[model samples]
Target chain A: MNTADIKNEKSVRYHGVGISNGCVSGPLRFFRQRRKMGRIRACGDQREERARFEQALLRTREQLDTLQRRAIREIGKKEAEIFEIHAMMLEDEDFLEAVQGALDDGACAETAVERAAEKHAQALRSLGDPYLSARAEDLHDVATQLLRQLSGERPDGDLSTEREPYILVADDLSPSETVTMEKSMILGFVTFGGTPNSHTSILARAMGIPALVGVGAVSEDCDGAYALLDAAEGTLTVSPDAEERCAFEEKQREVNDLAREHDRYLRSLINKPAITRSGRKILIYANVGEGREIAQALLNGADGVGLLRSEFLYLSMDRYPTEDELFASYHDVVQSMQGKRIVIRTLDIGADKQIPYFALPQEENPALGFRGVRICLAREEIFKTQLRAILRASAYGNVSVMVPMIVSEDEVRACRVILNECMEELEREGKKFDHGIEFGIMIETPAAAIMSDEIAREVDFFSVGTNDLTQYTLAADRQNPLVERICEENREPILRLIEMAAEAIHRHDGWIGICGELAADLHLTQRFIDLGIDELSVSVPYLLGVREKVTECK
Target chain B: MKEFTYTIEDPNGMHARPAGKLATYAKQFDADIRVHAGEKESDGKRLLALMSLGATCGTELHFIISGSDEEAACEQLERFCRESWGRGE
Candidate 1:
């Protein structure tokens, strides 16, 4: 009844996941593309058929080159790579060979290009790799470009005519097409199908244009109608009445004011240390998995890296990496850190992170089965190799070694013994390493949190990995939606455990840090500060926000 | 023929960008450059062929250059891979 009333009096609404927080009221414009073409009745002449195919290729190349140059001028070279890839696809020997074979079989130029591109695209679709499978669309994109050129369809004849700003809508958009759009006239984008992680959404957010994606299809009849798109609210109210537009305009202004306020406040806290009113200072650190993200973390003013997963080294490899490979990778990251502490976690694989070479057995419950420190403990050589590499990398910067899924004191003792053995071996080999590198363990298990005093006595520090602590504490899997509320309602229990662990660690003169999902929770930032966490390590984007919150705390 | 092995160090590893760059670079040489990753071999001058190799980060890319200017192609391309594509870190 409420839905019916809202639809009747104000507008009909379409919902989607919003990428940016702004809102705009503008005319809606759906992207239209020509797909079906009249079949060409080719003469039984092989030479002319081949010439036609060749001409289409040349025209497509010139168009792509123009798009590439424009993209470089407007969006930069990185985005222009999309067109470069298309150009290469247009000239690929395999693709050309397929087209030539089709031409030899007396098919027309359009039929040959379509058949060849479809064959390759079908092969790619069956590859089962989501990333590689997406390339099938790129093939179709290039093929469509060639077909349009072959049919003498003029490009850019209509885009110049849309002078007024409109919220563009599409089923999907290639990166090149999105980059080449006139930015000044684009109010926003509303895609019928796109994830926030898609290149289109990322580009939209980077351009500071609000976008509503994964909204299902908007009817063709709704085109040119005035729609108020509230991206923060993830609602598109088509044909909105004056009252609804006024409400949305007021909401947009308030949202913009809040963002402006946050921006100004965050800038002030950038270089300054986040100190509470009681003179307690909190360290803002970043959790990263890849080396490329380190640059962004430092750019965002992270004091240090709290949790460098160190699994990227393992994940990137076709096989187990040699000690030198591991050391060289870590050395690059360590040097780039420029003396800031990088807490390198040892191989935390086994459960969901299994390599084929490891031959880990499938379990009924993989999360509860052999994982993290358990895998490292059973595979001591892999553990020692990582420890040796991290210790060696410590020569360049303030590097710390952290262990994950550690639930017992014995695991800590075993890891320390192996670390000590590795250190002695490195010393015996006349290799350089930092002798006093700090060692820490993730307090993720409820058992570890309860046994914090004993665990704290053995380790230099404790970083609460709240993600797993919440999972194990609540006995709920994060991937399961049925028990999501059970996990949410029981967050206080996890915080209480963190409090207990913090007290125990502080008693032992060991500083505590939170490096899990909870670390970025601004609402719980004060609660974390009250619990005596000396450091809060979040992802790159949350660094300043957490720092800003800390400064406002008592 | 001149052949050498270099491990791919870029995190994205032989994806579209690097593969396109590799293809474009190889097309400039008179020599035929064939790159092998694991069991898969690809025409270095072809983007789709190189991407089909699926050489991920840490996967060794073995390059074999043969024909006229093989020595120069081998020398320059090896240098390019080492300097530009050597380390994702």
Candidate 2:
């Protein structure tokens, strides 16, 4: 099947990766870059040409500033920072000197800017860092804006000029260009080249628009042609015949109706308890990072926060966050939960997650190196400070303290000793805090799960971090793509470990929950329930769906 | 002239954002600041030049400040390195 012929023919189906979720049909318009630049007459004097380049730079700076403000209003601060970086690149000394060098050689302002931009972009590309090398594309984007300002060309990819909403077609859209477009004018997005993880796909998902990427090439002749896009099926049909159009419309109606009904049904289950048909009640909880996510968890009908990673405060600061700062943040989150249990996992850093202030040693195998409980144990002051804060916050609500990467009962005992010390210090200072705060350990390693029978006597409960338990048990790094499938296919060993942990914890009169990717795996929900798992904690979006699945479990 | 040495603490090294920030901050005074990363040297006011050093997290950066305001620049730059660069934020 020839792609070009299909693109130009009637009722041709093109396939690409689908993003977000929706179905729509509208006129298709091709997004083209403005390459035809108007040349300014170069004077015989070098100074005059240099001045012209300076003016374009100034205008480009002003444009970027305006775009930054617009992006902040339309998108968010983090995304808008792209424009801020662009502004800095525009003023880079090396870039300026390169442009000036081109001008001294008597190149016109437009040509000089293009040449300078390419030179810097090339330099960045050769740096061999994937992150920094990606900045090369950003350099080209900034230069394009400067060139457009110099040649007095209209902004590239400005969809606001289009009168009606249309499906957008492009080879690929840069983050800056995508954000600057008039969003209302976009009915959907079609790209000939891009991955599902591209910024265009992320923005499309954020806007809740149908998008198809890597659909090969759609001809410029196809612009303004009526087309139908079904993102759920990852298909874009150009010039759909009457029959195809009718079928597409019916499918679109079904999709829309199904979405609305599903949302309503999930919302209806919000306030109900997730009791299995076998008469076993399971707690449905949310996994959150910080205080900011409490509202989202509440809205999604989470019974409690099962895994509240306490790394957010430490990771964002330039220094060891004071005990008061940590306490205040924890207090707010605890109070917001309104008596619901929130398990605050102590700083699970060192592997993948690094903070510069920690000055952690470079590890040959960080996964097996100093991390989680080991780091907390080595740095007793940091551990004590965090423990003190969590204990103080427990006064306001139902709070549980969970330690990660515990491979032995000795580590649990050490943590308990420090926890006790902190409690004594809090009492001495007359700080009102809950005396009976629940303590727990994450069964994330094979050793921890195997020894759970003994460790269960130390902590109040166990929440299996299946992500690590799977990796550690199978001896495969899940982050390695080649070995990832092994971890997925080898869930039996992980489930068996969870079973061991569940049985051990129950024997000790303690409860067990799962707070990993496996927790939200609906396919394993019934199996987990059969193994006597008592709780499932997932991210906020999956809370309602998991709740519904729990009721279906026998 | 006043001089000081500080080690890079950011896992990302001297990437564009921090380099740009350092350059912007260096433009405040009449003193001339130079950063030496082993055999490579870069003007403290030049973002691209600083990034070109490709200094990784543990690389030491030697700073030399010279001019009429060398005293103030040295004190502030040392403070900046301790507070900002040391934390790598």
Candidate 3:
């Protein structure tokens, strides 16, 4: 069909899995599978052999280096670091030996490199460590690039076809790859492999892209066939009929209208407080991880930072950040807030976030073990360093120290004792600080929430970490898709805990803040407001929506 | 090396706002001036690089001047990083 005819054509029956959000009317563009290069032939002449090997190595390094630099520059430092492992692998003696061995065996360079990579990959896979297993994709990417370069094949450019309104179908997409795609032309994304916790999924959510992953053969089956993706339902249709398309289009239009209305509402409240008609004010803060996020949060009209995860400072560093390193970080955050209250949570690393330098032993149940205040208590020196840094920064701006995962009064008291010691030490050093800095505890565990009244009397504030609260209360892993129904935020127990926690804090004349997904939930915003949450801290993207909801709550 | 003070005009001060401003301006000059706040000192060019200094508003900090355009660089930086007269509480 001609371009004009296709633009006007409404009856073309094409099907594919939906990958991103929004609806667009345009011609379909299919992604071609990456071609694999075959083995290289062995050269009898040593000179030719050496030249070919060096050329291959240089070419592979250039491609990998370019990808790494681009990833770092465009995506982020974390995503860029993923390529460093591949770069190291290329220089490994063992890997080079394997490639050489393949060349010696009369195999083509492409086949030799692929064979070497496959063998090493098998060995790595057998080791079975999650950290190492995650590197498997890196290994694959490097090997593929080497093979393609050696075999004289050009590396594929980003999926930048001109066909508009195409649903991207893939086996899996890295965060960098996802960012490279034409966001406007891409309607949605469907993948055969990915988890909700995956960075790809997180980015998709941030971009308001509707993505369905773990759908087997959906991509292949629906290629060139029109399909409907129901992201809310996590379903992908293949070769959907006219009725289905019409229904989805209608639904998309409804969503668009709502979003437009939301945008208008958000624009109206750009400089306004999240106060109801009854004159009740709600402090809408932003949950920040890095320094860059602070600017984004303030721009989105956040009153201040509700939760500044200090883990990023340590995570981004190669080793444990020295006292000075920690001090600099805290100072940056405090200055960024510009006199606005910033509740800095001490390193809550454990479970999914592991620091290699600390060498924390693996726990049978990381969620319930050796994390948050527990880890801080055991590592007093590290904890003290963080506290000192926080105290030192407090002089610069409004800063508060928050303890995470406090399951008992003793843990809270123990943390307070250490914080007091840090304060004393800072006093001895003749440093200026907010001696009466507000202290808070993250009510993540049910035990902590149930005993909120007791904890509230000791601390100045409480921040509900609903992500962990739901996981702990429901005893369902948030990462597990099968247990998703059980781990819903609107569950009766969750609401009850939130209500009780808010009440307990209010009884003590202490404020309660929520720094979790539930805090940003528009549907539950009014309910939370009614429950008497003093503050709602959410991702920067959802700040406007939450602020609008707060205004409508009365 | 010469040391001078400047008022931070940006609302957020030396953290993200003034640091970004400093980074941009520093990149334009041939000489480098290291902005110091607390124990942190950052090369005046990079945004993430300059923010590493952690300078807050109303805080008097030292800027070590060296390099080719050190005199002009210090004057501009001191003016920017310090609070203006009657501006501070």
Q: What is the interface RMSD of each candidate, in Å?
A: 11.4, 9.6, 18.1
The lowest-lDDT stretch of 10 consecutive residues in candidate 3 chain A is: A1-10
lDDT tens per residue, model 1, A1-71: 11212477447788888887888889998777555454676554888877877888887887787677556
What TM-score goes with each of the models? 0.54, 0.56, 0.55
Give per-residue CA lDDT, model 3, range A29-146, as digits (tens): 3455473566446555655665676797887776666566445433443455445546656665567788889778776666667887887766544545433333445456677766
Looking at candidate 1 chain A, the ten consecutive residues that score lowest on lDDT are A1-10
Query: In candidate 2 chain B, where is summed lDDT lowest over 10 consecutive residues?
Result: B80-89
TM-score of chain A considered alone, across all candidate predictions: 0.61, 0.63, 0.62
Worst 10-residue lDDT window for candidate 2 chain A reads: A1-10
Second chain of candidate 3: TM-score? 0.70
lDDT of 2 at A239: 91
Off-target runs (Cα >4 Å) in candidate 3 are: A1-174, A179-264, B1-89
- Preferred candidate (DockQ higher): 2 or 3: 2
